[model samples]
Target: MKVLVIGATGYAGHRIATALRRRGHDVTGLTRDLAGAGARALAAAEIRPVAGELADPAGYREHLWDADVVVHTAMDYADPAGSDRALIAELVAAPRHLVYTTGISLHGRVDTPELDEESPSSPDNPLHFRYQLERELIASGLPHTIVRPAFLYGHDSRTSQLGRWFAAPRFVGDKDKRWSFVHVDDLAEAYVRIVERADAPLGDIFVIGEENPPPALEVFTAAFRAAGHAGEVTVHPISPEEWLEQAADQDERVNSAKARRELGWTPRHAGPIAGMATYYAAWQAANA
Candidate 1:
């Protein structure tokens, strides 16, 4: 299959592009700056690059023209409205499947341990605009699917809550505040599978992640110790209000069983807890 991935330079997009290539698909990664486009990563995956701006239709149209499927891995997209509308128009005109990458944060501040798809939608999340628009478009009868993935972690992933533990004096969350994460490769597989089966009456929303969600502090402390941080790991429990204020503005948890059952998608990474040590080792090496 031929596919075009927007934001292929990002942490998630890069891994997704590689997963598609490994599965024998012809992948073109769209990037604005080819110079910093993780050339080494793309080459390793055998995926080609298409330099262009995602917010501009003309810039992306050339690359989207003949793609069998367009998996949009872009996030905090500069022009989410315009880019989504334009791409939806393009994909609808050609009748190709389009996958929009959303986050669990769309569900709003998670004051609890877990949230499934049945959880009531949050009308108050400040980031709800784009997700709402994308949901509206998917319901507009266009060939589209919404993929809401949780904290993404994997190869060449420059950012991970676990990765932060490599640095000492890391702010560990309450010892039992749980969060979910998905491997980038697994997310890419889910995207590709959905695109391939586009004709099978696909779903409108799919969350991707491992079944296990670990306590935030435990995960980070393990990473800290693994990274050879000599200082004793500390757990600082913050109130929900304080958490919302201190933590980076993003979602905390997501459910992935829908995708697992429908698309046969299952994350290969050992969820967040098991992967902490590995992430710490990688982080330490990279930083050293």
Candidate 2:
């Protein structure tokens, strides 16, 4: 199948794009510019990266027009209200099966440890606007599915959430906070399966998360040691206000039971406990 990934250069998007290509799908990755580190990463991954901007549909309309599936994993998207509205309008008009990527952070400060796809929505999150965008896509009667993936890791240790462990004397987070850590490779495979399989029904929500939700301190402590850091990996208490401002505490433990049961997506890494070491090795090689 021909696939068009809008955020092909992004951390999540790049991984998913590489996964799709590995599956032998004709994939085209859309990037705003074909320069700098992102381009190098795409090349190293053997993904076909095209210079296309998500903000301007006209620039990427040709690629989108020809793709059988369009997966949007773009982050830090342009001006939320206006840009998203226009982008959604164009997407709905495309008449293609669209898979929109969202994050577990949308669950937002949930105190529960085993939240699922049916859990209550967050009152506020940085990606709260995507909820509205999701609604618009489904309401448009387009064949689309939403993927709310867990905290992403792997590929680049420094790019991972646990990255602070390497440089900082101590990391900050509530010890009580737990997150369903998802390896980027596993999450990417989930996307490929969702797009390739006909069983992934429209308007359905699937979580790309792990069954094992690890505490923040435990995960980072392993990461700290993996990074060859000294002293204890400090776990500081972050205020709700601080979390809201910086999106620091995205600690909502979630389960991908539906995905596992239906889509047969089994995440490889349960958490950062062991993967951190492997990722650190990769980070060292890349930085060296």
Candidate 3:
């Protein structure tokens, strides 16, 4: 299968492109620059890079015309509408198997419990325009599967929840504040499996993630230990009335039973704490 992957430079997009290529699918990375980070990270696959941004659908026509499936994982923080509109337009014309990425944050930070695909989504997060773009796409009724993943963590991911604590030594309220997350590799495979299943229903929504997410305090404390520090870690518990001030409130916790049954997907790694020591060791070697 010839696959077209947009935002091939992002955390999820890069992983999906690599996984698809390894599965023997010919991949074309659609991005602003073939020589940029996303393309560079995919050096192992040596995928062909199309030097066009998603905001310019006309530029992606040649690449889109040749794809058997399309996975869009890119985001334009500055102008999400433009990029999203472009991608939707392209999909409307060529409605092959399509997968779009969204985050659990759209549902706001839920700390009391974890949320699933069926859980009520806030969709009114104060972040930016991308959530609005997601709303538009869902209503468009294009043949596609929308994947909403919890916080995604993996090696070398600077923006991940774990990475932030490791790189910066700060603690949010209540270290035991629980949350769910999916590893980058696992989330990548979920998209691949979704695209492979031609018999799956249209307008499908799958929450791709591991079932047992860890608590914030415990994971960060272990990370500090891995960094050779034993400072008295604090677990600042956010007040019930102050949940909105917290970073992530995805308390309902995400589940992947549907993906596992329908897409044949499973996560390889457990929660981040289980492998904190191992990841820290690798971090030392890579940063050294």
How many residue pairs clash in all the candidates, one count each?
0, 0, 17
For model 2, the superposed segments whose C-alpha errors exceed 4 Å read: 35-37, 40-46, 77-81, 167-169, 237-250
Return the lDDT, model 1, position 186: 79
* Candidate 3 TM-score versus the reference: 0.86
lDDT tens digits by residue: candidate 3, 141-250? 77778888877777665556666666765666644455677888888888878878767787888888778666656777888888788778765554656433343633
Write candidate 1's Cα lDDT for 1-288 as tens digits. Answer: 998888777778877787778778899888776666375567657888777877665666767877877888775446767767776766666676677787676666556556666554466766667567766776667776787777777554565555544554465344555667787777888877887773577446787776556666666666666666777666565456653324434336666777878888887778655666676566567667
Q: What is the C-alpha lDDT of each candidate?
A: 0.68, 0.74, 0.72
Candidates sorted on TM-score, descending: 2, 3, 1
Error of 2 at 14 (Å): 1.5
Best by lDDT: 2
lDDT (Cα, 0-100) at 142 in candidate 2: 79
The TM-score, computed over Cα atoms with residue i paired to residue i, of candidate 1 is: 0.83
TM-scores, each model vs. reference: 0.83, 0.89, 0.86
Q: What does candidate 2 score in Cα RMSD to the true structure?
A: 2.5
Q: Point out where model 3 deviates above 4 Å.
A: 109-112, 127-132, 235-247, 250-252, 286-288
Q: Whole-model lDDT, candidate 1? A: 0.68
